[model samples]
Target: MQVEMQDIHKAFGKNQVLTGVHFELLPGEIHALMGENGAGKSTLMNILTGLHQADRGTILINGKERSFSSPKEAEQNGMAFIHQELNVWPGMTVLENLFLGRELKNGFGFLKMKEMKALAKEQFERLDVDIPLEQEAGLCSVGQQQMIEIAKALMVNAEVIIMDEPTAALTDREIAKLFEVIDTLRKQGVSIVYISHRMEEIFTICDRITVMRDGQTVDTTKIADTTFDEVVKKMVGRELKDRFPARAASLGEVALEVRNFTRKGAFENISFSVRAGEIVGVSGLMGAGRTEIMRAIFGLDRMDSGELYRNGKKIKVHSPGEAVKHGIGLITEDRKDEGLILDFSIRHNIALPNVEGLSSKGFIDGKEEQQFVEDLIKRLTIKTESAETSAGNLSGGNQQKVVLAKWIGTNPDVLILDEPTRGVDVGAKREIYALMNELTDRGVAIVMVSSELPEVLGMSDRVIVIHEGKLSGELSREEATQEKIMTLATGGE
Candidate 1:
């Protein structure tokens, strides 16, 4: 399938999302769409896949102008879109989700369960997936859920598949497996539009690249014809010198310490300490209890046994409120669900944690609240029309920034960040790193949990590896490397 979008123009209300944007997809080539969070990469793809109709444009499929009414119609015509957020029904079985809405039924209106199971198994086998068909979709790990999405796309016999940040939740090993599957699909003449912020992955897998900026196509070039620096310059309209800023903060005494942290069936006997003005990065593969330990520390989940020390004094945290009272804040990984209430305004989300300070006689000071929100928005460089804009209306990077601002308002002595830059773009990531440096400069201890090795290495003063449910090894910044971290994360000596 060959797809060509010529002079696509789309707008929602007065906000123009795409203005004369253009994109192309070849039959069997893996073309990458590169852009910042709001650069219109997703909007262009959404138009192509029939989720949104273009106000003015021309869509040519195999050189014939065509338009699809809905995403289902697009899928039926050999196009599939695997969204970043998986679309699996938590209550349904794996097999059920695989055949959802397109189930094979008998003449009497009975489900063909056996046939569905066989077909799903065939797709799973092709992707080297080992999940049980009868298991609930919610029980699977994030990596497994990603595989399920891939299998579902293949089941539709899609000639063109659009994958949006497909490997965000996957482990290193799982990513390697996915790449292998992509290689096989390309050999079978399936075209893929791969969208991701990871530069290494794009350079490694993509044959051609198209860069979009400010809702317009900036440059389209072959992978071999471009460099990483050139791509970054095009995406941001300026040269981004260093991927990470320099850290020059001095270390202080231990700010937060966890001893004998134990959560049965989750993680066991995890011990770590982060000092003021220091960053301790926790590195591990998916489902390796990295998130579990952070949740326990933040009082989101119960730990069967553990002792927490703050400022050299033991303390008890039974809930998130208690953690905040003790000057500890947590920025959850799932920002959409745990971090922000999407329906609320950006001012509301930022002021939620600091209500007491902004209130007088149990009534919020509107002037103070507005000024506070505006200052943080400007400080963080969040692009928005107004502070009253809904947080849901912001892009992925700006949403993450709002979450960070919310935590920073708490004036925490110790901060725990889990995958802070998971869905963010390169430009926003650099800004976040600079903010981390500034926080540490103010003597705030930080613990960063991440799966991206480059990020862990770039920002962390020290790195700790977790495997299964226990601490494996720890390394100083001077000694840590990707190879050593992976070795320890996999329980090697």
Candidate 2:
């Protein structure tokens, strides 16, 4: 399918999301849609997939004007959208999820289990996926779930597929497998609209790139013709100075120490320490127990036997409240579920932890709360209409800023950040790094858990690798190269 979206315009009440944006996808070509969050890339794709109706636009499919009233209509017409957030039904079997709403049945309305299983098996084989058909989707790893989604899209015989951050949850091996499948799809004459913030993957896999900024198309050029800096400039409408900010380190006494931390089936005998005015990055592949260790420290999960010390004093954290009281704050990796309440306003979300400071004698002080929230909003440069706006309405990058704002209000001595810039763009990433530098300057100890190696190398004063729930290796700033880190993370000496 040759898809063309011309002059697309969309709005939600007062906010204009997409304004005169244009995009195109050629058959058998992987076209990258590059932009910062809230730049209207997702909005334009939603319009194409029929999830949102465009107020003004023209969609041409193979030179014929067309519009789909629903996503089902779009998929049936050979277009499928794989969202950034996996839509797998956790409780159902992998096969069930693959054929969820389109189950096979006989004329008598009886289920054709054998036929469905055979079809699903064929699809998985084609994609080189090894997941068991009867295995519950939720039990599968993040990488397995990603493969399932791609297999599901292929099962529909989709001629055009839109993949939004498809490899966000995948590891290096899984990403390689996905790329192989994409190569096969291209050879089979399928068009792909690849949406991702990873510049390396975009340049490696995409033939052409379309850059969007503030709801409009800025440039569309072949990958060979454009440079990484050029694409970034078009996306952010500015020259982004550095991918990671420069900071001089001044080490202090140990701030937080985990001794013999053990969580059965999660992590075991993990021990680490972070000093004031330092960033200790925890580098690992997905499911390497990096997040589990952070959660245990934050009292989100129970540790079998471990000791936590803050400022050289032993502390017990039985709950998040207790952790906070001990001057520890955690920015969870699963932000949507664990970080912020979608229905809450920005003020409320930020104030949830700082309520004591914002309240007087159990009575809320509206003025003080407003000032506090507004100050953080300004400090973080969060893009929102107002502090009263629902956090769910903000884009991924701004939402992350709001999460950081929540932690910043607490003024914790030790802060644990998990995947701090997972879905964030290059510009927002630098801003986050700058914020990290500022925090360290204030003598705050940071434990950063990340899957991005460049981030682990760039922002960390020291790096620790985790593999299969244990500390694999440790490296200093000067010694931490990608090859060395990968070797350690994969359990090599």
lDDT of each: 0.92, 0.91
In candidate 1, how many Å is residue 230 off? 0.5
Q: Per-residue lDDT tens digits of candidate 1, residues 202-306?
A: 999999999998899999999999999999999999999999898876999999999999999989999999999999999999999999898889999999999
Candidate 1: residue pairs that collide: none
C-alpha RMSD of candidate 1: 1.4
Off by over 4 Å in 1: none
Per-residue accuracy of model 2 over 302-323 as CA lDDT, tens digit each: 8999899999999999899999
Q: Estimate the lDDT of model 1.
A: 0.92
- Stretches of candidate 2 exceeding 4 Å from the true structure: 126-132
Task: Please report, as a residue range, the 10-residue window in candidate 2 with the lowest summed lDDT.
Answer: 138-147
Candidates' TM-scores? 0.97, 0.96
